[model samples]
Target: MTDQPTTASPAATSPAATPSPLAQLPGAVGAPTAEHYGDPVAEQRALAAGRALVDLSDRGVVTLTGPDRLRLLDSLTSQSLAGLAPGSSAETLLLDPNGRIEHAMHVVDDGETAWLIVEGAAAPAVAAWFDRMRFMMQVEVVDASAEWAVIGAMAPADAEPSIPAAAPNGHALVWRDPWAAVQSGGWQYAAEAAHPAADYPAVELIVERAFLAELAGLARAGGVRLAGSLAAQALRVAAWRPRFAAEVDEKSIPHETDWLRSAVHLAKGCYRGQETVAKVHNLGRPPRRLVMLHLDGSDAQLPPAGATVHAADADRAEVGRITSVARHHELGPIALAIVKRSLDVTVPLVVPVDGVDIAAAQEVIVPPEAGQSAAVPRIPRLGAKSR
Candidate 1:
């Protein structure tokens, strides 16, 4: 693997990158995937114990190769890839000129190739965009989603996974999640005692598609329980991680989801939409912010994705919508929502599900002052010299 580099064409400035259901994405066949391995409660425990294997077969994979790859990606995405050492992982956003998120790529650099884990629905378009952006560069971008697959393990990044894409640093090309803290050149928007994902160590490994099933079976034989997408998504929602496939809307910006903590390379040079990012980060907050909703589980009904949420009691005006929902084994009905930043964070919200009012209490994920405030008049500007 080597360092390298998606969805708008060189001419298509803001084409939609993903062809996903605007609403909820339910499971196929008999039961949801998580229940396939017995109880979701047990699976959740297995996940927390670092003894679970999840099949993320629907995720997309892309590979970038060539000497100029990292530098080229540095000029395009939000994260700084120019100095990404082999086996190190970083996440980046592809924004339109207006700074709306078009793509979010979890990048892992090996010595030979840079593997990009993206949403399956956006793979083709992202690959096409990458091809178009290669005007005279010495880079090669290929959609390897069909040939390769992604598997989530409840393990540390340094732990060896079977049949992984080798990195020069002796570890597999695992895109270790940085959402646990404010990485270098990143900012923490949500002030908490500790990030939930800190206790949950999830590592994604890229492997040949043909070997996926075999690997899972081997892990199970070795006493590692097998889980599916539902369990994986539940853990992610618990972590407050913004998934491009689930949380993004047509108007999403990095700041909206508190993704600026890990995705935006604040100190990087100019890239598309860099001005918008800088302006938003250094002088303003996003128009909307992501939040967590502790949904009422008395009726045992889960709000589907895209379900409208409103202020409770007096006036039921739509304030936000649920982006992802999950019924955790311990947390019960939980979900992530994107709402207008002006809405009172202390108010209880309501989501109507099949004629029943499912009560939702707001948990602030992205603070109102998530970005830089224009009121910081005392702070010096970039080039301002001090007396």
Candidate 2:
């Protein structure tokens, strides 16, 4: 999710300081890693099958050290992190006062430090926010993107031998994807009997920046297969995994993207934007909802992100915009969009890409009735029979 293209690396790190070895590999296209090494479809298949590693050096790393690291995060984020055990991985959100998402982080504690993996463009801001919040607290925030790099794989960290795990303080640094299961104290908006996320078991490994050359050598020597950010993004979109770089905007709330399944603790203590979160879940619905679009693959035109989505019926009014789009290896042309909550699920959608209208079929992700989880009792009528 943090692998988007960028002109400049994170502020704490200088891209000119040391060029990435993976970026120098043949067919590498993007600034940090190869977007796709010639064939994206094959890379997607290999990555999904746990036979390939995704280059994610563009991701940003931040560390919180000192005795109050966990407590500081627990007080500011949506997840209950005070009791997070060393080596445990979790996801959390930093919301604005009105519950709009500002930051989403994948966190892992290694006893001595709590490492946060976040969107590259937002890394310096995240670190600065943490620093601003620490008033006399025994905590130190550092942007570690310059010293560390991230690698993604579909297998667990321990199961992948080619990519060595970093154990700076006896605990290995790995942030396992927790989207497969609804986390404790979290709620789900999608009512599917079988979720696609169940099949997505992915992990992001943190390693020393110096090891990038070795990994590149391993890739070149045929010791390990390499995938690209494009493949990784396609898999994430297929899994319906909400990412900050793709799904979040200034007005986005957790409920709109179904992010509560993994990043939010519904019963956690008060933090910034807690009131809006509780009110939305207990008494109201989000203003918008997420949906997956099966684009008309016959046209061979894949709509890019931010493409305007319109209703295919008469008048063809705009309803939403595409947040993320990809050509899934198995699902053909697909996209994730945020539309008005009241849009008819049965209504067909059309995305205008380069003057032609590309037909799209809607599959609901966050249903229209995506909130009001409170257990309020119904009021009985005066003439109702008593059981």
Best by TM-score: 2
Give TM-scores for every candidate, taking all chains together and pairing residue i with residue i. 0.86, 0.93
lDDT agreement with native, every candidate: 0.76, 0.87
RMSD (Cα, Å) of model 1: 6.6
Clashing residue pairs for model 1:
1-112, 1-113, 2-112, 2-113, 2-114
lDDT of 2 by residue, 177-290 (tens): 889889998889999979999888889999998898899998889888888888998898888898998899889999998999999999989888899999999989999999
lDDT accuracy of residue 294 in candidate 1: 92
Tell me the deviation in Å of residue 279 in model 1: 0.7
Q: Least accurate stretch of 10 residues (summed lDDT) in model 1? A: 15-24
lDDT of 1: 0.76
